[model samples]
Target chain A: MLDTAFEALKTFDWGSDLAALAPIEEAATASHGKPEARQDLENRLIAALKGTLTRDAQDYICRKLANVGTAAAVPTLAGLLLNKGNSHMSRFALEQIPAAEADQALRDALPKVSGDLKVGVISSIGARRDSAAVPALSSLLSDSDPAVARAAILALGAIGSVESAAALQTALRAAGDRRATMIDAVLKCAESLLASNQVATASSIYKAFTDESQPRIVRLAATRGLLACASQPAVRSI
Target chain B: MSVIKKPTRRDFMKTTGAAFGVPYAITSAALGNSERPAASDRIVMGGIGIGNMGRGDQGAFLGRKDVQYVALSDVREEVRDKSKANVDRHYNNGDCKVYNDFRELLARTDIDAVHVATPDHWHAIMVIEACRNGKDVYCQKPETLTLREGPLMIAAARRYGRVVSGGSQRVLEDYRKYVAPAWAGEFGKIKSINVNVGPLPQLCNLPGETKSEAIDWDLWLGPAPWAPYNPKRCSGSFSINGASWRSFSDYSGGGMTDWGAHHFGGATFICDVRDQQPFEVNYFDDSNGKYLAYRYQNGLTIYHNKPKTDQLLIEGTPGEKLAPKPVPGYKGEGGIYGDFIECVKTREKPFRDIESAVNTAALAHLGNIAYQLKRSLKWDSVKQEFVGDAEANRMTDRARREPWQL
Candidate 1:
């Protein structure tokens, strides 16, 4: 049955009977609940990616890999990162693989990919909250492609570390395009910072935005953010 | 081919509201306050299980310019058609997406949030899936059919960082807002509360299977154990006035949890039972040998008997006390609906958040176990279990049917 499902995965396409791929779904389910079973399935999925397959079939495998894949599957997924046809699905799996190797693969691909592919990989790095990618992502803030630059700032903010914050602050002071986008990213970083109990760091970012000198809406959000931070229990010493 | 254009509940709300002089609201969908957001700022919304309360709540959401109900989903084709028409009627362009399954609605990246008004059995799965799909959730109460689902529901919301609130409709579900001064000493001291809701019903042993093209019975029973479908059992007849599934313990805690979610939520608010339970629940069997009343640690007794006025009575220690004027702002007609939409925009938690449904939901389950035991039971509110009583504890979590396992 499993072999039949894998065979179906080899030629899987949109608008087909999904139940025919039930064994794949079953394996993904089994892998989610049991660590040992997931390892076995994960290895098999990675190896399957190495063999020839249709784009949709590779996608089906990637979709399942998003749930069960680890660092061992990272290289195969990363191989698809710059492929125009497969980058989105590849990044989808890598963004969630729960391994530094997956993050590094995405960060490593950032310079190698271009256009929309570059933008998608940069966004995946943010979704992973990969702070180590901050230096690489920070450099893209001045990229010729505004979309790529926007993705970099957003990803850096999602990383939400003091270093990422500093990079964003420097970018905000200097960037000519998408100033609103930068503010949105800064606020996102502020929120992530607050969730981590970096109240002082978050408060500084909020204070910078709350300056009556800033936009009224930005000031309003910053004001609320400051109050929300104040309302919680006192921040613990770092 | 039959489409229910307007649910019977819409008319029921008007008749019931006017007769009782209560604010069971269904205003025109065009009125907007100064606080109403701009068109682009409007939250894109969808409804899952647009049946009774779901449709009612969706109507209220349609009233707000800050919300756009872009899609409707339900297991029943009739329900989908009806809800699509309802939403289409509100939007001039009359373009509203419809799906037979909720997962399809979740897959719509355009959907910013979802209203999960599925049955007690389907609530957890639908809401959890919605949360994972990055949609804020406005789910109907009781939060889960059983106790174990409480923590899992909360964990899902927290993990995904989505704002989720239960449809306890605190503003409309109970007497808390209406009788505020009662707890604030206008009534001296609330000695006991006669919560006017029926006792738990026996297992659903409805005679025959109800098969019809109007509803997909299998989908309606998602997460609930496979059962023979009866019209009285599947999707429920809106003409019947209340969900019949509430009478079956397999899907609900009967009318106790149905109305218990309302009354208990109100009682706890009035009694200040936050972070604690009754510590005791004893049902003195009625003439039919059914558990009928219970007491709490605060000497506040709650009787399961129906009230003369269809409202719970908060009895004072000495004598009759004046029920002060109902709070005006607090009892906004369909305010909970607006509250969830407001939370989605502000990224804030609703006043009566999903977590607020936990204790009252727990009360409903505990009350059922006590009724089944046909005796008084001691409760451990903190641990959320029966003290030294494994039998009662086992009743807290029911076995989930396939693909619905938490």
Candidate 2:
């Protein structure tokens, strides 16, 4: 039953019998209680998910993986996410991994991949709340892909680390046309870092943000960060 | 399909305020005795926050005849009126009250239960207050603003003996149903569950806009620390000026608190790990410019990595992975609301109960504390305090303004 489902899923063009596959797939999962049956179902599902990596396949796989909600497909999903050429499918697969493993897998896969895949990996890692990817993510601030670089900047903000503060400051300084959004990301990151008492790091970052030569928004963010981190007595004395 | 014209903000505010002001208490007697209040009486319900999630919660209860629409509440008067009209139109209860103040609606003794669809910050107070007032609560995900509030809410429910359930509903299904049997054990012991709530994607911050007259700025700012009235905070738009409440610490705990309640809460439920203090809490706060890792005592770690898209990932021993499955006919994709209703009748534990809800809240709060402290701090779940960290401990409970004592 499970093999038949996988075969159907693999050969199944989503435009046609996609609706018909639900019951067979359901039966396979419903019978997942038995050890042998469950493994067979998972194996088939994983194969089907990997087999269907085309645009339609990717969408179908994402929907199927989302419906299946099993860990057995993590490796395949992670593999897809790490595949640099298939950014779309990679992202779709990355979105399907349990949030817990998504970041770790992406972090581990970051150095191994580049370009669109790198951006997808970085964005997915940050989205999964994998703060550990901060170092890799920080480095990606210089990523050639503007989307990836922006994602790195935003991911840094989401991760909220002091380590990434300087990088954000640099990114904020180098930001030419994309000033407002980058500045906002920088300020949000700086504010978060300052609140976390990454003061020394935040202060330096603030200094860069406050530099008169920088954009107006960056300066404002730096000023806010400084004031936010300032002691009450310091504020009163000033 | 009737193409409903969107109501203007001013019109919504006036209609909602007028609807709430009327002494429109709904009596259970109006519904047939079949819907009578009993130990197992079907809970006639009304939905507050009937926008994206509000409609979903309403749909769960609306399908059952045992539950009747009593009222609907939303700050956006348009949403409130539409939701009220929707229930009345659907259930044919033309007289149901459309309320702005959820408190007023909850005040009625006839309302046995209320489904809270407000933002994350409003959840703790609303749930606690609702339970305290004898109304069973079905609150949306990320049950509380902080970990500290979770226990307080659990206590309120326990003390008041109200059926309070969190919105992480995936726990209702037997774990074995979706995945293979061997895959479960192969996944190794539950190692760590990471939840990615948002990639609301990067958007530029806009200058604060003038508060529209249609909005009850004061009411919308309830409980959150006062800030300049901005449309972003109340309008629920992605723009900072429009939805700035999400970015501010005073209003929300960012994505973790907002979506963490759903994604992370799901893992806590599946693993059955409750009230266990993370040995240590640390955050990378890559938003500042770097990605870092937060480690916990149980050998579990949480990462706040940003993803390209919104999804959840769970990693466990033997490298098992679990992601959220789309459960159709299930409330909110995870069936959390439906489970709560079922539990309300059967007196069973919902997917994410008070204890687990508090634990998930604690975890998110710990992340916030770690972000604030800028250093990893030890925690004692039993003590409910940061071990030897006074400043961090201070954050455990927030200062509620007078007249709203926790």
**Candidate 2 per-residue lDDT over residues B294-384, each given as its tens digit:** 4556676655553332233446565554444333223222256666776666656655667776777676777765654455678887667
Best by TM-score: 1
Global lDDT scores for all candidate models = 0.70, 0.59
What is the DockQ score of candidate 1, to 2 decimals? 0.02
Off by over 4 Å in 1: A1-238, B1-37, B168-178, B207-210, B238-243, B274-276, B286-299, B306-311, B317-334
What TM-score does the A-chain of candidate 2 achieve?
0.66
Every candidate's chain B TM-score: 0.79, 0.75
TM-score of each candidate?
A: 0.55, 0.51
- Candidate 1 structure quality by residue, lDDT tens digits, A32-134: 4467887888887888888888665677687667656778998898888878777777875776576789878988898898876788787677756687888
Cα deviation at A195, candidate 2, in Å, is 33
Worst 10 residues of 1 chain B by lDDT: B325-334
